[model samples]
Target: MMFSATFTSLCLAAVAVALPAEKRAAPTVTDILNYALTLEHLENAFYAEGINNFTQQSFIDAGLPGFAAGRFSEIAQHEATHVQFLTGALGEDATQACDYNFPVTDAKSFAQVSYLLENVGTSAYSGAAQYLSGGTLTAAAAILAVEARHSAWVNSAVLKANPWNGAFDTPLDLNQIYTLATSIITSCPSSNPALPVKAFPALTFGTDMTAGQATTVSFNGSDASSANGMYVGFISGMNTTIVPVQNGQVTIPDGLMGVVYAVATSSDSMTSDNVTLAGPAFLSFDFKSDALLL
Candidate 1:
C-alpha cells in the first residue's frame, strides 16, 4: 500500500512538471513605444553619417541637398529631442543605447539612403502605435509625422523629385514599414542585429491584401544557382510563380501583405525544414541547411 501511494505521487509530480508553463500576455503600448525609440536612435545615426558625407563634398554635388550639413545636424538634433521627449515620459530605462551596427554593406546613392530611412521610420512608428495609449499614441503620431517629413525630404533630395510633392507622398503603414525597416536594419552594417541570426524585434509582418490591391514582391539569394530551389508566396492566396531574373533576383506575383513564405533547398538536401524563415512577425527567415551546418 505504501509503495503504490509513493508511485502515484511521483506520477502526479512528473505530470505537473511536463505541463507547459502559461505564456504571459503580449506587451503593452508603453512597452512597444519605448522599444521603438531604440530603433529610432539607430536610424538617427545612419542619417547623421549620410548627412556628414553630404556636407563634406567639395563645392556642390548633384545629389547633396542645399542644407545637407545643416539638415543632418538639425535632423540629429530632432532625433535627440525625440529621444529626450520619450525618455521624459519613460524614464532612463526607456532610452537604452543600443549596440547598433546597420547591415547594409554598401550604399552609393542618395535615393537609396532616403528610401531606407523614410520607409523604415514610417513603419517603426506605425507598428509601435499599436502598443501605446492616450498620450503615448499622440506623441507617437507626432514623431511619426516628423519621420514622414524626414522621409519626404530625403526622397526628394535623392530622386530629384519636388520636395513638397514627391512620388511616394502617402505614408506607409506599420506592416509595410516594418518589412522595409527590418530588412535594412538587418542588412545594413550601421544597424545592429541583436542576435546575428535574429531579425529586428520591432518588425511587423506584411498584411494579407485583398483582391484589387496590387502588391509587388521580390527576392534575392546569396548565390545564382540557389535561385532554382527558392519559392515565395502568401499563406492563403494562390502560390504565384517566382521568376528568376539574372543571378540573385526573383520576383513574385503578389501584393504586399499576409504571412509570406520562402523555402530554399539545395541539391544535397531533401527536407522541408532545410531553409526556413521565422520571426515575431515573420519578417525574414533564417536558414538551416548543409551549408549553414557547422
Candidate 2:
C-alpha cells in the first residue's frame, strides 16, 4: 500500500479541491466504476495505515478481542481486492489513491472509525447500484454485501454495538457519500479524474447527541444563519426521519439506532439531494436495550 513519490509530492503540493457543482451530463458506467475505485482506494489505505500503526496486542490492550486485529486484516484484503477489481474494470480511466487523514489515535479510535467507514461504504454501494445494470449491477451488489458484513462485524464484535441498525440499510447518493468522505481525504493527484459530483456545505453537531434527545447543529455557507423552514433529516437504518429545525436545534426522534447520517434539507424528502442545505453529518446512536422496557 506504499504510495509513490509522485503521489506524495502531489499531496504536499496542494489540498484537493472540492468537486464543482456545474451542470454535467449523466455519469456513464465508466464514471461509476471510477467512483467505486476511488472509494476502494480510500478504504484500502485506511486499513493499511490502521493495521500498520496498531498491533494485535494494542487492540487487546484497548479492550477489543485479540482476534480484532486479524479480522481487520481480512477486511483490508477485501478492500484491496475491490480496488483491484474496479481498477481492472475501468482500465485506463481508473482513479488513483488520494492522501487521507484519519483521526484514529489508538486502537479504540481505529475500531470506531472502521465501523463508520464500513457502514458508509456499504451505503455508498447500495445507493450507486440503482444507476447500474446487468453484470455491473451484479458485481457492485456483491461488493455491497461484503461491505455490509464488514460493517456488521466491526459494529458488534469490535465495538460491541448492535450488529444491525434495522431491517434495512440507508442508501446515500454520490454527493452525500462524497461529503462524508471529504472529512478524511486530504488531497488527490492532479491527474486523478474529476468526479462529476459536488459535496454540500459542511455540517457539524454543536452539542453531544443521543437518540430521542434534543441537540444543536451547525453548518457553514450562505445558509448557516438561517434555520427557518429547514428540516433536520436523520437517515438511520431503513428510516429517514425528518424533524423541523428551530433556531439551530432539533430533537432526534425515538427508536432511531446505529450510525445515523443527519442532513439539513429544505424539505423532508431524504432522497432528493437538490434539497440538501448542508450536511450528512455523522451521528452514532448505539442500540439501547434498556429503553425497550419503557
Candidate 3:
C-alpha cells in the first residue's frame, strides 16, 4: 500500500533533523539505534496504512475477533512510540522513514502480515542485544519483551496460529533482517545516512515445501548444478540445523513449528554472516497433528 506524498513528507519532518557541523563518528550503539529507527519507521507506516484501510467492522467481517482491530491500533501506537524513542535517542543521526509496498488487501491479510512483522521485530531485537551494553541494553530488553507479546497475541488471537514457537526465540543478524525488510520497502531518502549492512541476494522455493519432505530451492545468483559443497541452514527457534544440499534440494527436518528461516551457506556453522550464501527465505510450519499444515 502507498501513502500520500503529503503524509510521507510530514512523517519525515517529524523525525529527521540536522546533525552538527562536524560529523561525529557513530559508535556501534549509534549504528544500532539508527538501524532500529529504520525498522520502526517501516512498521509505523505499515500499521497506519493497514488500520486506515481496514476498519474494526472489516476485521470482524474477515473472521477475526471483535477486539482485533482495536488491538492493532494499540500495536500501531507502540510502533510509533518506538520510532519516537529511537529518533530521540539518536538525535540528529536517526534514519528517516522509507516508502513501502505492503501487500495487504484485506483484514485477514493484514493480521497475517502483522504476525510475521512482529516476530521478525522481536528477533531483530534479540539478535542485536548482544552488541549493546548498560542502559542501552536495558532499554532494548524492555522493548523486546513488548515485541514478543505483540507477536504472540497476533499469532494466537488474530491469525489463529501457534503463539509460541519453542523454549527460545530465534535471533537474526542485521544482514538477514535487512534482506527481509527490503522486500517490502521500495526506497528511502538519498539524504538518509547509510546503514553498515548489506542485503543478500533473493532466495526462492522451487517446489511445494513440507516439514519432513525434500524440497527444491534456488538462489538468485548461484548455480544449483555447481552447488557441490554448499549447505542449507535451517534456523528455527534457538537451533540451527545444517544439511548438505544435493542437486539443489534439501530435506526439511520434522517437528519444526512456527516460522523458520532457511539460508544457503558455504559452511555448516551459522556463527558468521560471511558464510551466508543467499537466503533467509521465509518458511512457516505448524505440525500440530501427525500431518504438516501445507
Model 2 gets an lDDT of 0.76
Question: Which candidate would rank higher by TM-score, 2 or 3?
Answer: 2
Q: How accurate locally, in lDDT, is each candidate?
A: 0.41, 0.76, 0.74
Location of the lowest summed lDDT over 10 successive residues in candidate 3:
1-10
As a whole number from 0 to 100, the lDDT of residue 191 in candidate 1 is 31
Say which candidate scores most in lDDT.
2
Stretches of candidate 1 exceeding 4 Å from the true structure: 1-25, 51-53, 56-59, 102-111, 162-249, 252-294
Of 1 and 3, which scores higher on TM-score?
3
Clash pairs for candidate 3: none
Candidate 1's TM-score reads: 0.52
- As a whole number from 0 to 100, the lDDT of residue 127 in candidate 1 is 53
Poorest lDDT segment (10 consecutive residues) of candidate 2: 1-10
Model 3, residue 38: C-alpha shift (Å): 0.8
Ranking of all candidate structures by their TM-score, best first? 2, 3, 1
Tens digit of per-residue lDDT, candidate 2, span 186-282: 7778788777777776666644365567767666633334567788888876678898887667887877666677788989665368799877876
On lDDT, who's better, 1 or 3?
Answer: 3
